[model samples]
Target: MVRFSYEGSSERNLKMIITFDLVNTSNSDGRTSLQDESRSGRPNTANNDWNTARVDELIKVDRRVKRKEISLKLDILKTNIYESVYDKLGYRKVSARWVPKMSDEHKRQRVEISQILLHRCQQEGDETVE
Candidate 1:
């Protein structure tokens, strides 16, 4: 056992010693470690596949839907609902409302349309657009 001390620790002067579990932990694959084992992180209690699909469908129906509204309607925590929309469903707020990330095809079409407008402006001048 080895005593480890931190002079600047603010946790009410907490101190500890090296334990056998940390020094000789043989993981199932036969690895010893002093670090925490891998974990799946926070549980996806509400932001699982089902909620993700629901969030997608809801956004499709109403782009102006708020996170709080989704939380109330789906009875899910706001944080989890937010994760489903932003992280899983790939949505971001634009003009105070969520907008789905554009697909590659949609982006290409937008670029093509912008190019056409640019060409028209060069030929006809900016005043002619209005």
Candidate 2:
């Protein structure tokens, strides 16, 4: 079927490419798309999966590891490491330590604690609670 599909040195190469493209295409049952595939602009070099994994490991090893420390250890830019830690790892700085962003449970606990503080302030007076 790929014999005359495209001008290729071998039909095998064209068949493989066509099959790959078909697999990538969504909802295209039997139609061959001539349009060029959309590209995901300039690739991220440092902020890729491999670096993100390394960044995660470093954070796990030391909760208080600074961005500069990671940058030096991984030999990557601090800015790129910052993106991996914050964006990919879902972590944030708290009291000079890197901590994972609060989960739903933590958020619920915070609400309960706030309610308790508010109740104490109302019953025992704000000055006493403070």
Model 1 over residues 1-130: C-alpha lDDT tens digits? 3456455367777656553544443664487665667798786578679878987888888889898998898889999987899888889999977887998999999999999989989999978679
Number of the top TM-score candidate: 1
Against the true structure, candidate 1 reaches a TM-score of 0.59
**Residue range with the least summed lDDT across 10 consecutive positions in model 1:** 16-25
Worst 10-residue lDDT window for candidate 2 reads 15-24
Task: Identify the runs in model 1 with alpha carbons over 4 angstroms from their true place.
Answer: 1-43
- Superposed model 2: Cα runs more than 4 Å off: 1-42, 113-130
Q: Which candidate is the best by lDDT?
A: 2
Pairs of residues clashing in candidate 1: none
Q: TM-score, each model?
A: 0.59, 0.52
Task: List model 2 lDDT by residue over 13-87, tens digit each.
Answer: 554334244444534565466567778888669988998999999989999999999999999998898789988
Residue 64 C-alpha lDDT in model 2: 92
lDDT of each: 0.81, 0.83
lDDT of 2 at 14: 55
